[model samples]
Target: MPSNAPASADNWWCDESSEYAFMGFSYEVTACQSPQQLQQDFADIRNTFNGRYIRMYGACDNDGFYDDVVNAAWDNGIGVHALIWFGFDGGNQWQQRRDSLVSTLYSNPKAKFVTRGIQFGSEPLFDGVLSPNDLASQIWDLKGQVKSLGIPVTVSELAYGYQSNGGAQNVLDAQDYLNIHMLPFFDATASTSNDAWPIVQNNLQFFQENGGGKKMYFDENGWPSVTSEGVQANSGAAVADVTNEAGYYQLLEDHCSDLKNNAQGGIGWFAHIYSDSQEPGYGIYDTNGNKKFNFAPRTYC
Candidate 1:
């Protein structure tokens, strides 16, 4: 994919190995697979994808499964944005979580090097778990302790959540980057596939201004490849099909130039997931190990 914009090396977000952004995993759910199975899956991803970054959910607990995840990621030459899950307001449990996470990191210093960033929580506000001010204070306090470790930290929220007037503006004010999930297919207006990029572009501008001059990343974005029998319901809207799902990937490859150009404000856009799982819908690979039409082969542009 040749680009009208400067080369990938000139783009700030480009990794030495690939032009694509990070990959994501539903770790809290998927890591439950057998260690051998998970290791193989990790190996397959490293051998196939050009990108070196990955995003994972949940802390390093639950029988040390996340420890295996981190070890496998390091073994396969990938970095991770590890998340600490939050449900409701935790009172004293918040400090306990911070302590546990710190202990995990302390125990696995080698694996910790592979951690690209620390995500406090994923869509905490959307789930009505905490107010923006509460979330921001949490993020700021965590950053105070962890920032000295030399990695960026932030939270993930829906696209509009990064806006100046949105409930998560305080969270936006606390992080180093504008980390957002841009899912146009789920928008109430319910646009077609072709409208996805334009929707993304428009949201980026909104986020850029409201993010307090911080850089941004589409930490999660992609349409579900399943149709008919397996359509994942979107807050009660019609299910997205292959037409929209596959088109989303092609649209990304076709506009790689615009994506890398700093004129658009240099954003890193990660695909929603790596492989199929019990979660259903968004995987670029089926549970049978087949690639979906939306599986674009990423490479240095």
Candidate 2:
């Protein structure tokens, strides 16, 4: 929590709150949930895990929700990073929404700690929503605008499968910080499989080589429930998922250890809850907010 703490113990990237905290869900932001309810939920989560940060995705039209969540986080001593979802139109509507949100924070300096810089776009490469070059341009422009307001910025959820050259290169060049979500399950194995280790290692190496001096954060990385889709159908078929929760925990511990020792920046996991709707289950906690069967891991470093 202390700003001067060592990066491994509790600095911006490798802090205790970020390394051990979970990214909160965004589905709870629908119109159904009132602002007050959202605040209460934020409080509950803070008390439940003593979380220091919460990741939230924001729609261009949902400025009110953004304001509510930002204020709630500030009141509760929780850091809120808003993922700004932009459409293809490239209109002022999205810009206006962003401006308003940033303006709100600037107007209320007390809430500065509650809100972090905007996440330009999520997984733009995978979604095919924006070309790498165009994405870079947009990110640069957005960062410039936010910086004009004195807000630091980062690109959230960059697709790791893409090579770390060209447009991806441009995005890193354009921003003050770069963030990547390393979902190892996309590799041959979800976690237990040997493929997982190298996949992460290679990605870390690439980021360090290309990210320049800019900080890189592992915004999202975790294993999901094993399913048939997760398995590889190669000459020798291998299980796609690691059913052993302890293996998953150990994988994280080892991975974090390596990340702490190697990566110039920091690393953090995905959600507290893993969803079965997706191929590989990706929740650390069940639907009811309870730690899943094999979710326990030693927190002391």
Candidate 3:
């Protein structure tokens, strides 16, 4: 019973015995925050929220940023959904990001344990910053480098981006799993409605139809509670009512069991964000560290 091996891939989501194997939240890095700061947050994500994954969005300029995250992540008993953000404007840091990612995997034995998987690019094709084949090639290249590490790899993109891009299917084939962004707040029909669950279902339907049945998961999905200090969200009939935020998350919490048990192999979702400071009003906790609601997320439904 005491034999030593990780309970999952790179300790993937969480140990098999974990109560929170299916929950996660999106974590963004605008700058190179200290490991102390990052560890504190990671501790909260794992201990307080019982989250098994943290989907990364952006990164600091430092080449060491990747490993910094990895080391801190495992230390807190949480795993990192490593994202080598290509950025929206498509700046030219391909070499840097590549090097950092590879090095991080090799730098520490804990690196792979903390890594949930590697997302080589995030929404790169949506803005035409990268071609489908080009993105796929990058994904394969990274896969080769990390073959020994055995980390699952993917390139995140919108459902439409995958549907419309000429070689999108190729990119989909290249990755080990489907990494898609499903945000109801952007949907015209859902954004204005009191109930976003229906639209969220539609979003998942879109992915599954084109997915060819590959395992899929949402890297981002949630509703913003506010657009500004006084301004409410303005997506047609949508207002700034803070209750809407809880509604979206509540649905996610409710269906966690269905997602894991689905025969189609859905990997579950990571909430859109962690705190309001990073994103105006999308956080579970506001700027003052007060929760918008009293409910907690449960991955097992």
Candidate 4:
């Protein structure tokens, strides 16, 4: 059977299969030429995806631009599930940026139409840029600010590397919501061992056991078909072709299964910047907005 073949209702990631639901795609707006243009693009996306929720981030520190994007999403009836207010290029002024973001959202009810959750920082622990307690405290403070504003908050970190060293525990202790970014790249050596699933499982288990009963979310997860350095082995040798796309789908299905009951939400790959040669093949839609693969065709049971 074809790998892209539609999975049945019995499939673990299927809408009827479990409680954990997958949020469609997390969009990046950096590629748009102008804020208005970006807003228009988002409007089209919202129409195309209809009921699915989309996660999005702003390009510059322009509140107006962010507001426009959010407004566009809302106008089209699209849900702007999560607002990644800070840390696009690893710049860590989370508190300041988040304050600005919250202020902007509150000032405009249209912007607030689609958002309540905020992603504080991305990959702080992996880069050894922020200490565990410090990161946790940041999350705590952000949550407090959002709650004081009468809205809920969520904190997301880079996957694999960021929370590798007790950072997960700290995040759990400090924040009620946890976000994980997951990317599955094929490695000849690692792929055989089913390394990806184990890592995801362990992280979920750790979070559940450590912090108070906070919810976990696979905030960002995807498989990339092309790499900057080209296809290579675990030892960095050139490989034949991009690993099977079917394998990618299978991995997603399995990961969704593991997160079925526990995960709060999920977001699939993405649909922008389809031409980044370095990270090619990651887009679910092509540069012209063609569907690369229908990973999830059904949204609900």
Candidate 5:
């Protein structure tokens, strides 16, 4: 995922006074050519989608990927929710990550203008690499450092994780907000694209009921058009893919239209992505920046 700098509601999708307060997307830069290209992409995303926020999955690396994203986002009036990678890195690695973040903020005098908040990691508990208590501790520890930089801190996890005993007592209590990744596609029980909202609604209910009613932010959600080999063999193959561009289009339209008004009652959502990637068939934009036939609903674009 990636970002754009913060802008007034006038510049974003939803009206400032509207009940629908947030509309955002996740971005990745693997298909970008240079910083200039990446910057233009951010500008295009803002101009085209009217999205105010972008979520990046991990910390900046020596390769300058995160650097390009931050610079582009700041220039294009987008807010970024940065996530730090914390699988098994040691204390030194964590310090380095912190240094990189602090440096990014310090170097950008106007960082407060574009920064939304921070997440300690994406799906640490869902992946089973970290226990619920461990994720809670990370959030508790990192919250101070993030606050020192003038940003809020939280962790992104599968919505179901929060329903667990530890999730309710530990994880929910440690974070400033709830950042959940709700991909019903991964659920064996989900039988169709239409099955998505019900799962999303249920998860939101779980968060609201067990989470002490913290604000909700869906870090990821979307349907893939093609059933590539990896996902094709999954248990829900019967409804895994929408099968064609038109079906995929309707799926997006229905999902977005319904979600805009908190239709399913989740406060807000970030569409799964901006463009296609190695993950296959999820991009709204092709590698050359061309919109797929069903990229977005007509009015949305």
Candidate 6:
């Protein structure tokens, strides 16, 4: 079948061979999968997606081992944005548990080489898990401990979280560079992927200014291909179809010049996910590891 994007399949493949095509992808560690399976997944992250980095949503499996994940990523020649997973500020156990993993990886020779930085938390303000000041202080303290390891620290939040008055201003102030989410498909103004670029352009300046003039990236950009029932889904006409997903990514390819140049104080982009077979249809690769679209990001249009 043909795609709905402006370009045909033959013209859709971007210059993914460029290291600046995309900074990284978001991935998780599954205990059910064997070490070999995880290794292949990391290989795909580097080779297939041309990702230089990855933000892991998971760390340890049942035996409390995180080395497999760290080693796979590093061995695959991809840097890792290690997660500290601070959900709902209940106590210090979450921090302490992750502390053990960092301590272990700290000794690995690859730690300094492939560990990009430690993402202290993901959308804590959006989830109401921590106050801006609290999360900022936590980022401060984490950087303090991990300085010898030579890892920077940051937190992810929605663009609105950086509101100047009472929002997560401190969180923005604490991060080394801004890591924010700006998903256009969720906006009512976006009827389809073709409509998404305008939304991104309209918001980029606001996001940049509110972000305090630091380097930034849209870490959770995504669009679904379909609904869970295997039918088309719609959010004000942002239809969940493979073609729409292709169209959304087409914009990514067209806009990569800015990222590659690091122009206007931007760093890179990491799409929402690599593969999600369960629901909401945002996976580029399906459960059987088949890529749904013949798409890649280019450094220029």
lDDT: which is higher, 1 or 2? 1
TM-score of each: 0.80, 0.73, 0.87, 0.72, 0.78, 0.81
How far residue 127's Cα lies from its native spot in candidate 3, in Å, is 1.7
List residue ranges in candidate 6 displaced over 4 A: 1-20, 30-32, 58-64, 87-93, 228-235, 259-265, 278-280, 299-301
After superposition, which runs of candidate 5 have C-alpha atoms over 4 Å from their true positions? Answer: 1-22, 30-33, 58-60, 63-65, 87-95, 163-168, 229-234, 242-266, 295-301
Spell out the clash pairs found in candidate 1: none
State the C-alpha lDDT per candidate: 0.63, 0.55, 0.72, 0.52, 0.62, 0.65
Candidate 3 residues 45-163, lDDT tens each? 88888787798877776767777787777677777778887776667786687787788688766787777688877777877777787787888888999988878898777877776
Q: What is the C-alpha RMSD of each candidate to the true structure, in Å?
A: 6.7, 5.9, 3.6, 8.5, 5.1, 9.2
Q: Which ranking of candidates, highest lDDT first?
A: 3, 6, 1, 5, 2, 4
TM-score between model 6 and native: 0.81
**Worst 10 contiguous positions by lDDT, candidate 5:** 8-17
Clashing pairs in 2: 10-15, 224-281, 225-281, 272-285, 273-283, 274-282, 274-283
Model 4 clash count equals 2
- lDDT for 207 in candidate 5 is 73
Off by over 4 Å in 2: 1-32, 58-60, 87-100, 107-110, 159-161, 164-167, 189-195, 226-246, 263-265, 268-280, 294-300
- Best model per lDDT: 3
Better of 2 and 3 by lDDT: 3
| Number of backbone collisions per candidate | 0, 7, 1, 2, 10, 2
- Local error of candidate 2 at residue 294 (angstroms): 5.7
Model 1, global lDDT:
0.63
- Runs of candidate 1 with Cα error greater than 4 angstroms are 1-31, 58-60, 87-97, 162-167, 227-239, 263-265
> On residues 31-74, what C-alpha lDDT tens digit does candidate 5 reach at each position?
54478976776787788777777877544456555566677777
Error of 6 at 121 (Å): 1.6
Better of 3 and 6 by lDDT: 3
